[model samples]
Target chain A: MIQTVYIIGIGLIGGSLAKDIKKSRPDITIHGIDTSAQHLNEALELGIIDEKTTVEAIDKADLIILSTPVDAAVKLLPMLLDRVSDFGLVVDVGSTKSEICKVANAHAKRRNFLAMHPIAGTEFSGPKAAVANLFQQKTNIVCEIEKTAFKLQEKALNLFASLGMRMRYMHPESHDKHIAYMSHLSHISAFMLGKTVIEKEKNERDIFDMAGSGFESTVRLAKSSPAMWTPIFKQNKDNVIETLQEYISNLTHFKTLLESDDFEGVYKEMDETNYIKQILNGIQ
Target chain B: MIQTVYIIGIGLIGGSLAKDIKKSRPDITIHGIDTSAQHLNEALELGIIDEKTTVEAIDKADLIILSTPVDAAVKLLPMLLDRVSDFGLVVDVGSTKSEICKVANAHAKRRNFLAMHPIAGTEFSGPKAAVANLFQQKTNIVCEIEKTAFKLQEKALNLFASLGMRMRYMHPESHDKHIAYMSHLSHISAFMLGKTVIEKEKNERDIFDMAGSGFESTVRLAKSSPAMWTPIFKQNKDNVIETLQEYISNLTHFKTLLESDDFEGVYKEMDETNYIKQILNGIQ
Candidate 1:
């Protein structure tokens, strides 16, 4: 029964959602709102949304998705809670969950807010990087559904299903912790790996020459936007740290086996971690 | 001036090298030697090499390249050295260096051997993965050059140069230590990250849903062959352990900041790591 949808921060995730939803639901009015007028203009020209709206312009919409960065999402949630229509549902697609979820939890419209994080993105960002099928076969995490009204959660569920994403409900704390290990730590490792290699190789040509798919895979995060990631690490700091420690410990153990010429032990350890293959079997 | 060259292993690295060398020097006869007849047969069919040869068949070649897994390279080098012509040159493209260099150094034909590692590979392996442009503009690391005879090193210099690779020289020990940090540890971190997520997510559909580009970049190495990587971890265990420890320590420090609600410290730490952006400025 949702008719009008407003998307804030029309960057990669938001813009792509706009594009896909527009492509599928021809009758639903899609309104794009962003601090960047240029992004809004681009989204409009691309027909990603029906039109661009100011924060105040789309106050009547049934659903408002805050697809901004983590810090921005936290900062803007209280204000939107103040102005959102009685039946309107507000969702966020930020990477970090705990802070934003907590910010909206105490609101009078707390039952009207649904905390959402759709896990789909590319190395590239912005409206230009947005694509029609970005969310297809991806996972969407909806944190603390108990805080939202059952009807609002139901509305959010329909939105995710329409976009072809499977949904998981988690506590905000748990979501941040799991993601820190599974996502944020990876970024730090990649950035550090890129930094380490670039330091040793000195000449970019050496990295260009020596870096194969291994280095490329490990360092791909180096190309990620500093603006997006810095806030994520800040928001999910504890979890990110814990996951990083575990990862580093595993690696240190691996090194000790190699140093001692313990081929049998080293091979067995990797073979065990190779159980990761079984784990990846589940990945789409 | 190298007219006839032999390539052992006939997998991605060896086959790709043969194809590129043939493209660059049509008159140079390329001989392929692999323990797997299927691979040797495929190499010929793909025109990756000009002809298939056996151990004795390639004995008289001017140059022999051992492009096999680290385990296989260790086993094959001693045998190849026994048959190498007094004036012939031999090189290896194994992932690990120090052990391979040590095994070859005490051989009577030690002076004829050049311990080399071309820092390039895709996730895919074998002849099918072989592509002609693999080594172009890549790095070819020649280790323990002082152990190589002057004449043989000259030929190695020419061969790597012919492949359009920039050359870096290091003692084999140094190469292993540095590479453990740069290359080996990255794979372990990626594999474990993939495992950890897979373990918790349980549902592949959930992982696929939640996995953004960050997860993909961090887990891409999970697609790599366990056969190829097992020996590498075994060989470079010492340095990998050290690097892993340092990495873990950093993570723990960051985690402590998070637990203490030190948002300022967390933000500042991530900001410092962002300096990696400058280091990677020229890497394309």
Candidate 2:
């Protein structure tokens, strides 16, 4: 009589969810599917799920979770629409929501789908990157919630609540815009900073020895997998562009202040930005 | 008799150097000096130095260490030039070099002064921020080394070696430029990124709670002391500005690629930047 939950793309988020659910909720039987056989095998080995399932096995599940990369989520969601049962609930934990939501709009089981983005991840990826309590105390933003079936929304909210996540409701487009500034821009800045330093410091000795935790922390995401980010960037292109433009303009103004030897102005600029401490306080 | 070392403005860097020297060479007596009684008291309580000294004490010591903020270093060097004994060696560990180096150029004890920057620090600042191994295995960039007397150079090198730091030599101007890209730009990007996110996610609860280690790493420097960074930006205004300019331009180009939905181009950009992995490997 247990609820059957099937997960697509059993990587960090998916695998972590499976592990937590298996540990916390005895009545939920979890099924995991991944493109990588290694990930599937590891998920089984790690007891991340009760069993491994194929695409054909998805039809029997009462709830389906898409934890794949953004592009892959688009392709996988359509295939699952036909296989999902009448009572099935479907959700995706992709960074970009608008495109995926649009792609799934015409599906037969469109009302069964809920778009979700759990605002959590590390620079590291993969099933091995999965950790217990990964979603604990994190925020899971559910977009276009009104479009989802009422029963499915209730089920999804209850599941997220059990996993120790608070929820925020937003439209799909708004989620993409807000996330580009809060998340995507941060990754781009970190990556390019790493690139700039790496390009200039011809000898790796300089970066390895001279770069401190500050540089490492700032550039940590530069080490993130290209497979994951390439699609998110493509899907959230407009918002990312807008956010990056603002970021770049700010940097240019800062540069001009420095170029003019405007010591007071430069100091003032940094001081103004230091207000971020207050902003962080607000977010926390 | 053991050498007597006078450390002026004994804060984090100064206090740490004092601690290291005390640990390495018990025979060497370390005297601390600071305009701030609070810092002097904390340094005393921490046993970072043997005793507190006045400006007049510079003449009696075998070596004088300038460990204050950049502004303090600039103003104090002229006075120390007149007071220090002829055989005494003086070293200033300031973030910026050209300004401090230029001010000390015509001093009576010009050869007695060595302009050095230890490329090591933490987000914390002040006397309490001092840690025993802060400079261990780090790179210390010595600018305009040819300007320092041979005897003084030898003494400075030995002291840095005892502290377990490798050394790199560069002209003061070049050091500022290169470090602008590597160090200064990193801080600016971090501060502003923090600002942007805080601004956008004003009322979003648990926004920071959802921020995994990646966000923390990128924004770590945002927690740095405003007092410390305010002076640095003021002192290195021109170089910091120019570096910020280049960084912003690069970010703009990235934003353009993302906006155009150029997934392949985005993939290539990130992959190219990942070369930093090889660069980072050399540093550690």
Candidate 3:
């Protein structure tokens, strides 16, 4: 049984994990560390974590979760692993995996670290955005799971299972590539769409009055925190660029069809994409 | 009092209007007409309409509502107006307005027709998707309202008010232009995002397993019916193309920042767009 846990970057994902763990395992002591003192205070006030701590606290904990933005995690994971006790386990809950995994690949304590991506979140961020059961029924992708020590892997699996997550394993490279299309690209598309509309419609009231639920849904990701996302795009630059190119190409082709008044072509494209309904239903 | 109301193209918007009117003003008879006999049958069975009738039955109605696809509405609005009695009122709830209004501009009974677009609906379609109070608390854009006779305008206002809608008036050209930025472009952006992801991720389960609420919201418009949206894109081609160009430019600029690792620039862009949170709140 785990006696103590230390969660770094105690924002949405970290705070939420702490809440679920605290509920399920009351005997465990959950401590929080964050670069933002404001977030740390919020987590403590909200009872998401039992105490405030620092990297120096790693020696006393059985598990350490690096839940910072991807760039920060890449820089911090190896340094944190160096400080972990022999039996302590370290795992990162970042969106991108390739850079984080590569930075820690040859570290002396590499076997103590696990690279994970929990496929769940809201557009909101920070500790206040954390909620109970945020990870329930969600998919958790562990990249290069085989690189971790067997005992550490077991501990990570048990914790995620307790949070009601289904785990999938993939190579670091594969995880980054797949997520570029599925998740990161969607955020960029929404951000760009929001930027475009705001630039064109100078009268914000016109947009507020005229836009419908469809527009609301499509641009919802524009509200995401930039501090969290900018690092993600930087870390996964190549795959994101490739996905953006494909997305722009598709948009241009659609524009051409609209320009030429090819109604049938537009109709056929939307009809084909309608199959996404079935895929989305599967997720629900 | 509206003794009878005839709704053509009895699908989502039309069927929903029928349902709302029946609840709020049951003294009026609600009749539905659709090229799709299946939709007519469903609307009747759901009690969204009192009867399934044809254009031949339109002369007896006190009001006529054309809620067909824009292309079909462009053709039928003029023909339907030609058949309306002097005391009868005709209005359209099509997405695009310029083309439909232009086509009927020279009709002898131009004063009998009102061009309108209700700023509401779910991604779902067909009569089965109809909901009472769908227009409640929603804005309704009335294009070329002055072109309709004063009596007909008052009738349209009364019905929309009874259905709990706030009305805004604009010229047909302005309506098409503004909606292209506020609504049409959003749908295109979502459709292209969905297409790009589906094309790249051949394994559908990967997308299903990994996509979170953000991706789901961004792509929700992708599930819209092609039959409904295709004509809208075709009718508003110029404005749609212009909006698409602006959207593509924004996306390309974002991609360039990502390519150069300009994290600050990326962050600033999203930060500015975060103003959308206030705008969306206003919508709610």
- The Cα local distance difference test for each model comes to 0.77, 0.80, 0.88
What ranking of all candidate models by lDDT puts the best one first? 3, 2, 1
All candidates: interface RMSD: 3.1, 2.1, 0.9
Put down candidate 2 lDDT per residue, A1-284, tens digits, no spaces: 22898988888888888877777777899998888999889888878877988989887988898999998999888888887877888889999999999988978778989899887777767888888887877778888788888988898788777888888877888888877877888889988887677666666344355565567667888988889999998888878887787777677766666666766776676667666666556556
lDDT of 1 by residue, A21-127 (tens): 77777788999898888888988998888887888865788889898888899999999988998889898899899999789977888988998788888766788
Q: Pick the candidate with the highest lDDT.
A: 3
Better of 2 and 3 by lDDT: 3
Provide the TM-score for each candidate, comma-separated.
Answer: 0.82, 0.89, 0.97
User: Any runs in candidate 2 off by more than 4 Å, and if so which?
Assistant: A1-3, A26-29, A45-50, A146-159, A203-208, A281-284, B1-3, B25-30, B45-50, B144-159, B198-212, B234-238
- Tell me the lDDT of model 2 at B20: 88
List the pairs of residues colliding in candidate 1.
A138-B209, A139-B209, A139-B210, A209-B138, A209-B139, A255-B237, A255-B241, A258-B237, A259-B238, A282-B204
**Residue A79 shift from truth in candidate 3, angstroms:** 2.0
**CAPRI rating of model 2:** medium
Q: Per-residue lDDT tens digits of candidate 3, residues A128-169?
A: 998999899999998888888998789878978999999988
Please compute the TM-score of chain B alone for each predicted structure, in the order given: 0.94, 0.96, 0.98
True contacts kept of each: 0.44, 0.62, 0.91
